[model samples]
Target: MADETPGFELPLLLFAGFRTLIDQLHAELARQGHPDVRPAYGFALQAIGRGGATASELGRLLGVSKQAAGKTVDRLVALGYAVRADDPADARRKVIRLTPHGVDALARSAAIFEELRAQWATALGPGRLRALEADLRAVAPLAGVRLDVPGWFGG
Candidate 1:
């Protein structure tokens, strides 16, 4: 069945669902002993976890200005979640790497995400959930949305 509003689009529906999911997930994460991290920080962790990246690269990945990205890096570094080290390839350049604590946090967050997904599956039913996922994946590219940025809606 469609939503109540006449001519309500698919994107808006998806946005509402996604917003709710992320808000709940963030609450769950805070309850799970990760109160310091926001969704934006999570995105930074994911980006940095894929090997390492320079501040400029992270800026691009995060769809933020270089200054904003730098501030984010500063926050992460201050919190001991990431480190800024000189890039081996270019001494003048710096790369961000997650610390052991950051690594552990990422692992924990991933587990929480899986748990949440399972809960969704249970609520929505396996077949319907799978179809929803497949349909979203099919239409995702048409919308020019970036799949990797969990904080896109929140930030």
Candidate 2:
């Protein structure tokens, strides 16, 4: 018999699965001393990366206005997740870098994600989970990972 799932259901199901993972991540984060971290912050932190970025650079990476990026920086600073420091190569520029706290949160998130994936694998059967991942990789865009999801989602 042909699959009867509606075309519109595919994207919605994908999004729901993504939401489930994120929701589970945030729940774990809250228990591990990062209750304030939001989904948007994850994308912003990834954009900032190891070397860090100026507000303008971050804004471009996140596909948002400089002011929006600055606001995110402000919040990160207030939450002790990041700091603004003078760029060594360019004293006039201040770059936003992740703090130890932020690094810990990211690390914890990574571990938690692995656990979540394991849970999914157990539920769906390991072979099915692997197949799902392979199928997703095949269909997903070839442009590499994107860091502008927060802005794209209008968050």
- The Cα local distance difference test for each model comes to 0.81, 0.92
lDDT of 1 by residue, 51-145 (tens): 88888888888878678788999999998889999999999999999988688778888887788788889999989999988887886755675
Q: What TM-score does model 1 achieve against the real structure?
A: 0.83
Q: Best lDDT goes to which candidate?
A: 2
Model 2 per-residue lDDT tens digits across residues 1-155: 99999999999999999999999999999999999999989888878888899999999898889999999999999999999999999999999999999889899999999999999999999999999989988999546767888677786
lDDT of 2 at 130: 92
Q: Which pairs clash (backbone N, Cα, C closer than 3 Å) in model 1? A: none
Off by over 4 Å in 1: 1-5, 141-155
Score residue 136 of candidate 2 by CA lDDT.
88
Give all TM-scores, in the order shown: 0.83, 0.95
